[model samples]
Target: MKVAYWPGCVSRGFTPELHGSMALVGPRLDLEMVELNRANCCGAGVIAEHNQELVDTLNARTFALAQQTGASMMNICSTCQGAQSECQQRLDADDAYREHINTHLEPEGLRYEKGGDWSNKNLLWLLVEEIGLDKLRERVVRPLDGLRVAPFYGCYIVRPTGRLGYDRFPHRDKYLEHVIETVGGTAVEYAGSHKCCGFPVITMAKATSLRQAGRHLADAIDADADCLVTPCPLCHLNLDLQQPDAAKYVERDLNIPVLHLPQMLGLAFGLDPKELGMDKHVVKTRDVQRKVAELAAA
Candidate 1:
């Protein structure tokens, strides 16, 4: 399966490792990812809070790129997926808005068709539906047998169907767990699996965001999860980068390591941790790597 990849702004700027790991893992799964050329940010969710029209125009350009690529555009970041996909739906449904966006695209020789034959897929959804869990299992050279990974599906990626978008078919909450099991790891249940990681409010409400993230970490610790895995780079940031603050907020030393989904899958694919850029994480992946080695030995 081939798709155009949009790594999004934050992942390109703050989490290049996510892209690195995906590039490594995709070939193993028979998934060919071509990075979308001249693609821009898909509003990052925060932009809509300030300017809705700007968000629509910017994301319409992104869709035009996907349309030009001839394959559906795939996003590694949850916010980018949500923003662009929601914008696509909006532009398709609203005639006046579509015309307005097209007027902006006309100068660049790009025109977004209201009935455009393209899709904006999230990586998690692409893996589960397109690649199939059995195919993913077949690519697992080193099964992560005995590892308990807690799946974290941060806020924006999964919802607002009742608000602004459509419901994710086949249920999105199970996508992470499916990928975890496909790589031979146990997906442990935790309260924060479906809760927000508090990333969206991090800028405006730092204390509240830390407390919320702390609550999720506390849940994961209680569940005895070895580490947390997330599809969203922003969620990874909140749970991984803000871990220190979260520990202070909860008044406990939460030593849990966080892994981007691709990084965790790379370990199962028998790729080197260094190649996956595991060391760049705020929370170390050394322990996770050590555990994977032991699992391979067993």
Candidate 2:
């Protein structure tokens, strides 16, 4: 089972280990991962908000690359997966956008396939469906030992409502929570778990973004969560890097450490701090690492 891996821009820079974690665990789950050697940015929020042509082109090019591999594509970022899946949906429905994109690529002899939803899978969907909670259970060498996590969805993972295409999952925070529990960690529910992280507003108005991020941070911190974990890179960026600023601006100590979903899952499997790249993150997950070590020692 080989699949094309799309790391997107943020994961390439900010959450580098996510791909590494996937590489480490992919084979264990019977997946052979092949990264798109020529992949570029998924246009983040640019093409979607600004140029429809480029959005079509960006997603089409990625599908073209995946076709080059003769394999389906799986993405690590919630934003990228959402973008690609959205583009796929649009291409699947509208013939005009599809032909326009394929024409742009025709100079290079590339084209989007007809009558096909470009094969794309989000990690959340893959983990729940492909990995199976039962299989995830057998691999838990290290239990989270009661460190509570606030299951933060923050929009992208479960959007357009019905695209996830699975049973009774209802496209909610419960999917990631279920996976988290299999690794022995409790997914704490809170008020702001489904709210936006103010990622789009961050660039235009810093205050609005900080206010929104702080509100979410306060909820997780107020819940006494040891960490805030989510699958979106933008959410990780906003919640982790912006919290200190948001805290001061909001006049409260959020002091909450943020973890990428993969980072937390890696820890739950006893992968250790170095292997998980905990020290390199903006939040410096070292304290969480120390807590785990101390608890393990006792």
lDDT of 2 by residue, 19-61 (tens): 6676666665677888887877777666788987788787898
- Give the poorly placed runs of model 1, Cα more than 4 Å off: 162-168
* Segments in model 2 whose C-alpha atoms lie over 4 Å from true places: 114-118, 162-169
Models 1 onward score TM values of: 0.95, 0.92
The ten-residue window of minimal lDDT in model 1 covers: 161-170
Model 1 TM-score (2 dp): 0.95
Instruction: Give per-residue lDDT, candidate 1, residue 289.
Output: 83
Q: Which pairs of residues have clashing backbones in candidate 1?
A: none
C-alpha positional error of residue 69 in candidate 1 after TM-score superposition, expressed in Å: 1.2
